[model samples]
Target: MGDITGDTRLQSRILEDVGAASHYRAWLVSLALDALGDEPVEIGSGHGDYAAEWLPHARSFTATDADESRVAFLKERFAGDSRVRVRKLLLPSTLDGGFSSAVAYNVLEHIPDDVAALRSMAAMVRPGGAVIVFVPAFPLLMSDFDRAVGHVRRYRRASLRKAFEDAGLRPRVLKHVNWAGFFAWLLMMRLLRGVPRDSLALRTYDRLIVPAVRASERLMAPPFGQSLLAIADV
Candidate 1:
């Protein structure tokens, strides 16, 4: 949600046309959901791109966004779904504690005060609960696409781990994802300064390369990637 920035319609289209990208995202969500309880919360649920996969597993799910427009869209998207609730919540939100788990994907880089945001996220969960986060990796890979997407900075493993520790969350798992995507992003977005959009090249990458890269990561994760994910405990 926080990762792809643009008009809401444009964002939805981007997610839809990206083909196999959705599978990779569902894999990440599955990893996060492993540690989650029945009642979970998703922060920055833009357009609910991954909602369909996550919703059925939750006893109750709260999808929150900083943008009122996005919240409205989510409200309509989940309308009449008894298990789901949509709300507008700008971070450092006044959210209460005791949720089974908290999750955010591609969100930390969007906030200027990412540590504070992590702290706020941790506060929403109960003791011994999980807080899963996924964020873009490597500041050097940043470009106009990242800027347009409202990314302040990308993360390294250490930086992300530090943020979790500072937030009073115990860092449990950290791994890089999408090995091929690292170089592809650098060449397309950084060196070439490509603008964000849905395209045949991206579709090919997602459809062909993504599955291969994911399969490789199962044996041993790459040292660097286009993004990093962490599973922390509160």
Candidate 2:
């Protein structure tokens, strides 16, 4: 539910993205929901969809974005919630929030210097805290939509681990998710020409298709997937 720093593609579609894939976004949130320790800070917390879902489980949550408009939206959206704080954050920060957990979902791929970005997230967290990162995976699956969406690079599990290690964090939970999504992206995005907007087709996939993938992966972890989720310790 967050944005990538320095990436403005589909900037105006932040809310649309949240609305279109409501179920899908919820699926993404569920992966890291339990790992989010107290006093969590989420980077690039776009329109705050993930924040809204995760906040009820956390003691305190900070939602941040590089885009001012999205920051404003998050602030207004969470103004009544005392446990939530919204702010504008740029990458390579010196922030020291001492958060128990820091997270970035579909955010790090937009940063060219992902290791430095991970470091920035790690800096905000206290020792023994968690830094949970989720990003699109598989370079072969890179499509026109990914470029149009301003993704710098996709990640593999090993590379993602290296990034965490480079950022001086210890990776604990590293896994591939969305087993079927790898093939779906290959056919729909790589072979297809355009970016997908909010549509019944997406909603249908989110509802009918995604659950089966989630269920299968939960039963047995896939060797590779459409995305990599890494939970590291500071």
Candidate 3:
């Protein structure tokens, strides 16, 4: 229950209709979809984009977010879509039984109680079901941009795995992402500590920098850059 309703330039930049960010987000959703197979529940669904992406493959889909307005919008956006359902509920509180898989993209970092969140997700799914998460990587790399976006903390693979394990879930995959872009971000933003959030510089980075970095992800394995992905089972 962190106060994330802040108006910041960084929020505007990342949540805006930037193609590169959308592409990377979609790519991550695709990975979750592959792991989920024909049906899954999506937690922290912002605008329903991730659920929309999985609609064709998913037999049924449910999405929830703490933001009531966003949930209302999602409900309207998919009103007639029999495959989709949207609701407003806080994390782990809204989770319940029956889902075979769960997804929480770029979400764990925002919660103050990360371990509790993981445990709630574990309790929601069937014993053998999967829970996949994506979050910003490396606590040392935390910046104002993270704060603006309401991130309580960044994570390393081991720490994230520990959280899941402590919640009675078994880690299946945990890795870093956007490796090539990590140094660039560090140099331009973290080290310099001068890059303004949502500036032209950031836009340029998203356009030019992200494509190159995403291309490199295919060549490398997990533990790549500044973002982490973890998949665990209940």
Candidate 4:
């Protein structure tokens, strides 16, 4: 997550995909929300989707993005909401924004120096404040879609834990999510090497598959998953 500009075309397509995965997004965000305390800040808040969902829960929210167009969109999206503030910032940021929690979803993998970026997020918050994030899991799942979306690398449990520890953050919740998604990603993303576009198949999965997986995970955490959720203390 350097100061380098993002590929807007690629970003737009990915954001569209997020929009299509309604239940999927809701479940993922619900899990993330449980970890975030009040006065939360999000890094790389693409298209403000997460911010919109998270803002209602947080007393005050800060949403930052490195892309200029995304920043503008975020400003417009949250302009009427006084409790929300939007900023243009890249990872490894120096700003001490005085937030209780710093978060990012599917953002860390884009950073070549992810540990520095995590340290920067930790710096933005007060002591004992949390740094929460959700990132793609399993390097073997690295597909053309990941590259097309600007991912530098996917992560393992140990790798993510090490990153948190190296950044002086103690992991409070570091686990894999979406156990079934691991197989779906391996076949659709890795084997196929194609991006997930808006389609009936995606919506069907969101409707039928997501709920069952989420419920099962609540009962028992799986050994591995398609993604990793990490909540750490600064």
After superposition, candidate 1 runs with Cα above 4 Å error? 1-20
TM-score order of candidates, top first: 4, 2, 1, 3
Q: What's the lDDT of the predicted structure labeled candidate 2? A: 0.83
Each candidate: what lDDT?
0.79, 0.83, 0.73, 0.88
**lDDT by residue for model 2 over 1-234, one digit each (tens)?**
233533364754845654777667888999887778878999888778889899888989999988878888898999999999888887778788999898998888888888898888888889888889999999998887788767888998888989888888878899998888888888888997555667778888988998788888878999989999999877
Better of 1 and 4 by lDDT: 4
Backbone clashes in model 1: 0
> TM per model?
0.90, 0.93, 0.84, 0.96
Task: Please give the TM-score that candidate 4 achieves against the real structure.
Answer: 0.96
Write candidate 1's Cα lDDT for 101-207 as tens digits. Answer: 88888778878777788888888999878888889999889887778667788999999988888777778899888888889889988999875556777667667
In candidate 2, which residue ranges exceed 4 Å CA deviation?
Answer: 1-9
Per-candidate count of clashing residue pairs (backbone under 3 Å): 0, 1, 3, 1
The candidate scoring highest on TM-score is: 4
| Alpha-carbon deviation at 173 in model 1, angstroms | 0.5
Error of 4 at 224 (Å): 0.9
Error of 4 at 146 (Å): 0.5
Clash count in backbone of candidate 2? 1
- What are the per-residue Cα lDDT tens digits for candidate 3 across 65-171? 77766778689979999888787766656457678888898888877788888877777777677889988888888877667678788888888988888887777
